[model samples]
Target: MKSSKLSIKFRITFWYTLVFSLILALVFFYIYFLSKSYSVHDLQEELKDESADILENLYDKSSRNDILYNADWTKFYDDNVSISLYDKNSSFINGVLPEHFPDKVPFINNKVRQIKSDKNIWLVYDYCYEESPEDSIWVRSIASYGHWSRILYNMLWIFAVLFPITVFISAFVGYHILKKALQPIYTISDMAKEISFSVNLSKRIETSNTHDEFSYLADAFNSMIAKLEKSFEKEKQFTSDAAHELRTPISVIQSHCEYCLDELKLTDSVREEIEIIYKKTTYIGQLISQLLTISRTDKHSFKPQKEEVDLTLLIESVIEELQQKAAYKNISLLFEYIPQNESYIIQGDTMLLMRMIYNLIENAINYGINGGCVWINLIKNQENTDIIIKDNGIGIEKEHLDKIWNRFYRVDKSRSAGEGFGLGLSMVRFIVDIHGGSIAVKSKPGYGTTFTVSL
Candidate 1:
């Protein structure tokens, strides 16, 4: 997710610039060719007009002499527009041709023409004047195509300079525009991260009043979160209330079992059955108590009473108390401690902290191998204190590692045949959390499991 954070903006900018460049190129080509075509058309019209103007001035409409021979044509020898005279027989009477202008080209009247001559393009126009009904003189105009070509070359150079600049400006502006357009998406993502990290569900994303797609997305997200928060609240409330309601009946059952064993004479089989009932009720009572603890913790009602706890002696006491239980399975409990010149002490809830360690060690013993060993270690330093409990037992599968800290989640083997329900690790995690510490577990299926707590 972090790697692809900028991916959306990159794709938007890339596609936007590509499309903008194509459109700009099309517009550039349109304008360029339009200028070329229009310039040539206008030049042809100008040649026709220039020739007609010159013929009107030079022609002798009243004189009876042959007009081509009688006229003095030196005034017509000028740059930009060339003037030439031709007879009706298509022979050159008198004229001036621009440099490299092909002289062999025959003249035709009443139209402007573009002709290529010796690698040069020239525009030619002919105007006819009648000396009589059957005799006439032609006034021809010639201009080079190079004059307009220079203008087009400069235009090409200008476009060459502006194309990349326009594309760059377009991409830069497009990225910022898309960023603003997608800002609401970023807001939603940040809110999601905040909710996941802090586990806070009441926060809602702010949306604009305008009925846009982003507003709709915000509405959907807020609606889903509201439903989820409501559902979780109902679940937690049910759990809390059920645990409270069942506690009294479980205590009454245990009390009756105790009274039966102490006061009434019972047969061997009846006593064993009663003992099993008492044991099962005791486990259920523990489970209910853990559920209540978690419920109170979730509601922010369970505050730990902090006191200085001896880190070294705590492990020893738990190990001593659980020694008889381990002896039943022939599992040896070992304690490893180092003073390091500093007091092996930490500030936390004594009962909760002791229970935290107690649960971990008991969990190890329950799953431990017969005649195997369990190691409980206490290490202290300036940085922090660590409590490590490890066992060579029937280890957990990789998939069950994450779910062990969740309530009532046990592996299939434990469900079929295990001493306790899967609430011990859940309570252990809660206690560690209440003391502002962290716990981690590592295990392999066939080897063993190890628990590490840091305070």
Candidate 2:
């Protein structure tokens, strides 16, 4: 199975949302990093100030050792800050240690270090005081980061909730905007598709009032279609004129040859040559007639005279006319009307319908083997009437089936030596199309060919 493809609007919306979400994620990360950095920096500054004040007070007191021993370490403990002091031996001297504090503090030469535990994060500032050579002491001021962590946690929740919502909203808005932007293109495409050589090419694409790219594109497409319409008109005129001009001369040649053969005394050899000339002239006349019909049909100038046509009777008449030709090859031509009493009635032109049936039967007879059979079945259902022409003849190749309906396209070029100019099927297709009917052919190379025309 083939994979389904995404439409342009969907693709554009997806890319827009993806890029926007990526940019938002980067911005959120930057903000988080900046917030954390600023919080840590502010806490470091406060810890430094507190440490300096404690050190200055210790130096001013005359009995510093007595004051140190008598200091209330619990007073320094608060919701946002914790302080701890240690002596030269790395033993805790005073101040409170928060729960779950590490037994060892890795000193960083007076710089602050961050320590994390299961409960809280701490920023420790290790300061050294040289009161005397033998009495050097270390003061460690630690501050809790629980307040900053809570702020960051709340921000994380906000981002998690808003990211998908933002993406969905952006995708929705982008889809509509892209669809509206491409609306004119869709209109232009639809109009172009409706314009064809057989259709009215005079119709132009509708343009927008705004002078945008879509408007410009519409104008350009209209101009191109106008040129195409003029080209087709010229081509149709040439075909009609050529066919008309050649018809009179071919008829004259055929008539003069017949008159000469009848009225003048001619040798047998000369008479045979004249007969060939007459036959060729007749063929040329038929070819010109077909060309003229096709030209008119292509120009949409051949308007059918609509009437209730008995399709069964039409097929029978065509078969009767072509029966002698089929008999020459010993081919049997049979017709079967499904409902004997009910007329296979349809609204169409009598002449064109007859022509269509004649072409199909003639083709089958010409291509069929000697003593083969051609069957014509007229079937009527609730919706439409079906004319099925099946021939047990030399079947057409699969590759040539599609091109058989094309004008002047022969499935087997060798068939050109016969009475066909390759216009019969093309004409049949055109007649079916103008009548708002459908025709389909099924064939296999060694078996047979079947043409089903539904009207």
Candidate 3:
């Protein structure tokens, strides 16, 4: 979609049709020239046959003196064909010729030549012989080349009409052939898109019975999916095992720290050190919980407990809950378009939806500048309910915008620490997708960032 280049199917069909058209044109021209050659050859042969007949009569009927008078050349006269005679000096002696015929074309003995005159091609045949020791005559025939080439003319007309038709038919049939041949690629692409959407890796593409390139491609795709499924299974097991195993240690550390602070009369420095350990341990527990949630979703075990919850009240409550956190930076929170009578209700797991909203607002508050403001707007329509969270924070850079939704991806690499593990936006994306909704973000450095969630 991003590139204007043509699809493989269409490109293949286009090139196939173009090559076929070239070959077809060559064949048409060959047939045209062959037919024209045959028509002209037939006319030349007729002229030779007629000249032979006249000579035979002249030799058999009279003496050399009266031979020209006895033989009737007028028998060959027609509108488009003519028989004539000339002397040894090439002077016109007798016979008929069409009007505007090019008589200037001198006779060449025993040859057929073409002459162009009066905007027409004239086929002229000259036959020279001796009647006596001192007398010679030339028998010649002239025929209208255009008038006698009807077969070749008709063939050209037929080609002119059939050329485009043949090209069109070839293109149509070639497109279907290419489509059928490349169906396996299409099948693989469609399956890949489905896997991407549903996050299911157990499916495989079907290979063909024959051992061709397409079949090889299908086998490769199936193998890749099988590997992904195996790797995904390992990752899922590891996260679950790690989360469960770390929970006991985290609890043990927290309990020991609490006992040390409460039971022992510890110094201020010692107590603060223990408290820091407890806080870091708690943060680790939260991280493990997030990893477990993502793992369960991947395993198809994290099903939402759907219930009707009012979105407006839920958002307002989340804002109130995070008010103390935002006050740290003196950032103000504003809510807009609070409906008076209309209730914006949706079916989802209330806790998960609240977590989704909480994470986004918390991220805004964490990233916001001192004295900055965050705006939350509720937009209702016939099809979808939109929640817009906009903040005048230090906006993300252009290069980092796309990567912000990736898990554990932090944009500010120079900084040692930040409030989030960079998983909040990733979790938000997953939540919206699972609920059959969508999310989008817009940000520009030093200006603001906006998150739109449509359900």
Candidate 4:
């Protein structure tokens, strides 16, 4: 059987109750037995005093003819207390004797003892009276055991009634106390969760005025968050500054290469070298642009201008623009529109949305086989629109699939530098995120690759 799990509050309460119950049981037993011992001792002493008094009275009345024989013994006896007297000859004397009293009372030890007879228990005390040296009488006193038993029984009833009540009250009170003690922890956890998803890093967990462990924890968390916010801001500033500074140099290099190619007649080898330099400069400019875009997006500075966009026309336009590039590589580009409508409308930035589609289709063309086919399907549904771009080319490995969205992460590192700088997919992902859409890619090496955008 599986063991049931208990929460911290219940587990604490359980241990508390268990320990208290053990202590309570020990105290109850000690009190019961201690009280019984004292009661029995006091009863024995009282009996001894009564025996002495009876002996004194009998001694004073010894000279009378009928003092011992006719004296009223009923005055000294009740239902619970019994007294018996015996003469020196061991003959019966005038005194009260219980119905179940023993025939012979052992007086050699002169000690008190408890004796049971059928249903009744008795505390029997025996005493020897020396009335003159030669004549003596034995006295025995018996008290019922039911008095102390009743006292102990009532005590047990009290404990039986109070034990469960005490446990319940203890558990309830403990639960609330624990909840109050842990409330600050819950508050801190909630604040941390809010900070995780929110861009406002200035927010901190509230701390108490008292100096305690929880206050220390809150202070530590706030300090860590402050440090992280500072580090992130520095990184963003560096990216923005670096991209901006590189833009001018890249443009100067491209212009110099163009001037060299156009203004001077050069050999074929020299012209080829100039064209390569121009191509590299242009690639660097694009990389800088993508970096600036990503930095602006991180700083929440790139706000898309809202406008009605026809997604079908936008996609067709991108395909038309990239048709020559696809033709150069002999790749067939195909478009399949599920709705075939003239306009599939959405509210977004036309330029950014067009960039998003352009990146995906361009990636399909670049990565596909020379004569392979690339399929573009736009499916419209009741709730959303789906754009799928699929290519039968060199599909990505499984390990690199998740990392493709990261900036400057290339799946095939051995590819030529001119092929891709690894910024297109990153920009595509950024645009999808800004538009509150989702993009997913499924690829298997040597099979095919598929990109799905849901908006």
lDDT of 4 by residue, 195-226 (tens): 77445577899888998999999999999999
Candidate 1: deviation at residue 313, Å?
3.9
Alpha carbon lDDT of each predicted model: 0.83, 0.84, 0.83, 0.81
Off by over 4 Å in 2: 1-5, 62-79, 90-93, 103-109, 157-161, 261-266
| Ranking of predictions according to lDDT | 2, 1, 3, 4
The lDDT of model 4 is 0.81
lDDT digits (tens) for residues 1-455 of candidate 2: 99659988888888889999999999999999999899989999988877776677568757466436767865456545676667788887777777777779766557988898888788888888877888876777788887798999999999999999988988898899899989887888778777753478889888769999998998988898889889989988999999999988898898899899999999999999999999888888889999988887786556988899998778888988998999899999989876757677889999999999999999888788789999998888889889999988778888888989988888763244246889999999989988998999998776779999999
Estimate, for each residue in 1-455, the C-alpha lDDT of model 3 and write its tens digit: 48758889899889888999899989889988887888888888877877776566557645544545544556657545688777888887667777778756877888989888757788888888686857778888888886756666788888899989999998999899888988888898999998889788887777768999988888888898889899989988998999899989988998998899889998999989998998898889888888877777667656888999899889999999999988988999998875656689988889889989998898888888889999999998889899999998888888887888898888883111247777788888888988999998888877778999999
Kindly report which residue pairs in candidate 4 clash with one another.
none
Q: Which of candidates 2 and 4 reaches a greater lDDT?
A: 2
| TM-scores of all candidate predictions against the true structure | 0.79, 0.90, 0.90, 0.68
Task: Report the poorest 10 consecutive residues by lDDT, candidate 1.
Answer: 60-69
User: Once model 2 is optimally superposed onto the true structure by TM-score, how far is the C-alpha of residue 155 displaced, in angstroms?
Assistant: 3.8
Error at 415, model 1, angstroms: 7.1
**After superposition, which runs of candidate 1 have C-alpha atoms over 4 Å from their true positions?**
1-10, 54-79, 85-140, 206-220, 262-264, 300-310, 343-351, 377-387, 413-417, 427-440, 452-455
- Supply every candidate's count of residue pairs whose N, Cα or C atoms clash at under 3 angstroms: 0, 0, 0, 0
State the number of backbone clashes in model 1: 0
Clashes of 4: 0
Which of candidates 3 and 4 reaches a greater lDDT? 3
Model 1 Cα lDDT, one tens digit per residue, 1-455 = 45656578889899889998999999999999999999898888778777766676556455324344665656455557788777788788776778888767877777778888766788888878776878877788888887788889998999999999989998998999999999999999999888765456888999899889999999999999999889888989999999999999999999999999999999999999999999999989998988887787676345789999987777788888999999999999999886576678899988888888888988888888889899988877567898999998888888778888887787986322447668788889878876778888989766888999999
